[model samples]
Target: MEKSVFEYSHYRSYLRMRLESAGRRGSKAQIATEMGVQATYVSQVLQENAHLSLEQAEAANVFLNHTSQESHFFLLLVQKDRAGTKSLRDYFQTQLDEILKTRMVLTERLGKSTQLDEKDRSWYYSSWIPSAIHIATTIPTLRTVGDLAKAMQLSSEKVMETLERLENIGLVRKEGLQFLPGEQQIRIGKDSHYILKHHTNWRLQAMQSLEHENLKELHYSAVVSLSAKDVDKIKDLLLESLKANVEIIKDSKEEELYCLTMDFFSLLKAQK
Candidate 1:
């Protein structure tokens, strides 16, 4: 199925999907006419991932009948594609991040109840399962115990017990055999007392994942001695990358459950 325009970061792919939608066969010519360009030009441009002028991109936006937000996103995609230098591309990328953040703010924002009490924190973060199950309920397919059990590779009884425990903490709400996110939101910060346990739970999960032969999963380990100066530089780069990635996660629609773990530390003992 074709995704909404907002879901696409690549303009060419979005155009191709629209043109090829059912009953819209040969729609490239229509778009060309809308943009005051030749049909062949549109055809070649899409196939080659060629740049579209800002003016042409605006015309295409109108032809596609995009919403205001989607039009803005579409223009950003074009601007990024047309950028000739890394700095220019990075500039447009920042704008794209803002657009995504604003769109997500209203729907994804957590409530004031995000901070859990001490006991609740202990129970919730004791193992990854409780928190994981709470988040999984947000996924449409994981609403049922059987569905979640199969997806998370757990037995139905285990899923049920975890679900019940989560419900007690107001993390999951059940309605007619379907599970949904609870009214209260849960957000843990680095300063949280249980943060270490939460991190440990997921880190252990990461280790187990290595046992599986998933070709698409990523794992990297390195041991090296570098200048103290470069240590800060490398750490800064990783933090910057993770910050950009968080923007994507905030705005992306949930379709699957995945975990990302990044660890970098000094092997040498610290001097007092």
Candidate 2:
């Protein structure tokens, strides 16, 4: 008995096995012809020297006659393999396994419950408090109002107020004299109002950072015209990149807190 198609982690290997099982074995040229690509390109992909583009992958999926679920799995395998960073590969691989095991559509799973309560929502949207609390968690010496205020370059009164709010919200717990981060997931629903305010505040802060003379942070901007289809692809890539960064940060051994923010939007309407 052979392994199922879903068991193969590598898309190239899966394609090879799929082709062989379909009685189209030992001929790269045939596969290339089906995919409308050159024989050498197919050879490179099979040899792990190259990868399939999104278009190529979709074409191959069609050629293989994969069902919707199998096609999705194949695309995820390609995404996992083509990921530029290890963190991204790991994240997508995890997602692939979960989807296969649970027999759940990725989009449907993503749309399910992962929301913060009102208190947590309010606590996270305020921004500086969460940052301060995270920093304090890593640096025990920066636990008190005066210490945190001086470290964060804010007034003691403001830090005190934020700390009290965080405590009331159950995001921080007092262990002896030091504050520790609560074991909580800070997830917000897609339609949450806090999402808008959170993004607005960060975008404003990002713009403000440009005016500071001694700023050492990185800021980049680009404007380009793209098809709506390509825009959707870009959005998916951005989301995957964000998730990858979160995974990387979560696995870090040292505590150097930093906020990662990204903003992408259309600046012009498509011409009819």
Candidate 3:
């Protein structure tokens, strides 16, 4: 499962694109020249047809201006890609951001060819949330919980207990009989800061890993205080907003006021 230079090149290319977007500048040609390689070889790396050596990587740092950790991450990606096992892109997508950030630390011991030790397995399981709260808010309204459980074919009590735990952490709120988030909820665990620090690299992986992305439709029976006359216009505005994002795939309407949600890893990369 050792990574080939070709795979390493792909990682370098990916980083190059990301840095470009972040307003950083670099030249692959210049880096190749510095490493005493032909620009064509550099082109192959960018095309993912070649790999990078530690020495070449050092040269890239001079050109791409990546930090030491970043250079290492790029190398890891390439190595993982070369092993021809799990696709790093797929892994990145599937892994929570928190986990992705920290996994690098144990690369030597947990890279593609490595097996999880008993302790590592335990740590991995401990970091995983039983279920993800997919609602717009962290707190689940009773009705929302009922519907979600039915959809997932789980008992309502199971869902409720999970929400209750989230509530205990000050991550959820109850207003009257309805559970909702006190504010916006972005999934973060104790190890999530690393995700923010390496946001772009992880974001691309997230975008790739969301293949089964789905949204659950939810409706509330409560009547709103808003004038009925404004409902049509509000609905129009909502529809417009939804259309603004090409990423929004599924949306459903129900008889009562409703919201959309789905369970997913918020920060699997940093779960622990």
How do these models rank on TM-score, best leading?
1, 2, 3
For candidate 1, what is the total of clashing residue pairs?
0
In candidate 2 the C-alpha lDDT for residue 129 amounts to 59
Which digits, one per residue and each the tens of the lDDT, describe model 2 over residues 6-123? 7788998876765555556656676677778998898789888999998889887656645455678889999999999999999999988887767445324334534446656786
Give one digit per residue, the lDDT tens place, for model 3 in 1-272.
22222233356556455433433344555677887899778877767678777687667644543334445555555555555555665664343334454644544333333233433333223422322342434333323555656654667666666555544333454432244553323343446443343344434434544664446533223435555567677777766766763244344322232323222222335745
Candidate number with the higher TM-score (1 or 2):
1
Question: Distance (Å) between predicted and true CA of 193, model 1?
Answer: 2.3
Report residue 28 deviation for candidate 3 (angstroms): 2.4
How accurate locally, in lDDT, is each candidate?
0.79, 0.69, 0.47
What's model 3's TM-score? 0.27
| Greater-lDDT candidate between 1 and 3 | 1
TM-score of each: 0.57, 0.49, 0.27
Residue 169, model 2: Cα distance from true site in angstroms: 2.2
Q: Candidate 1, residues 1-272: lDDT per residue as tens digits? A: 45666677778888888887688877898889999999989988789646789999999977775545567899998988888899999999899888777756633543435555667777888888887888898889888877999999998777877886665556776653466788876787888778788789998999998899487889888789889999899999999999999999999887888887789887667742
